[model samples]
Target: MKLKFGFEEFILVFSISMFFFGYMRIKFTFMVIKVTDYYLYSYGNKGLLYCSLGLIALFTYFIIKYISKNVNTTR
Candidate 1:
């Protein structure tokens, strides 16, 4: 069956991509920063980190819910 791609699908894909990108950015940031500079780096990008975490959480929740709903419906 051919599935129709719509706004919700687009959003889900976008969110998933953004989640990975944010994860990689945070990982790289931590990897590049020295232990001694951790506090300074965190302080400078506190808001950005928080926002990334928030998006990650939100995306995870929605993704899980979506997958669960699909699984239940398919069964």
Candidate 2:
């Protein structure tokens, strides 16, 4: 039998990437909160951090919504 890969698999992979980025963002946020001086010195401004996190989150949300819509249509 042949294996099939489609939208679900695509979403799964993309979701994993999103999760990894999200985790990194959270770790940086915690560092910023716990060690403001060092974190700021190392990472510069927080605006880029927040912006990247928001974009990743928004992309992931849209992917999830797309997956749900595809599933509903297939059924």
Return the top candidate by lDDT.
1
What residue pairs clash in candidate 2, if any at all? Answer: none
RMSD of each: 5.6, 5.9
Provide the TM-score for each candidate, comma-separated.
Answer: 0.48, 0.42
Per-candidate clashes come to 0, 0
Give a tens-digit lDDT track for model 2, residues 1-75.
777887756665665665566556666765666566766545533545544655676687687888989999999
Off by over 4 Å in 1: 34-75
lDDT of 1 at 13: 70
Deviation of model 2 at 23, angstroms: 20
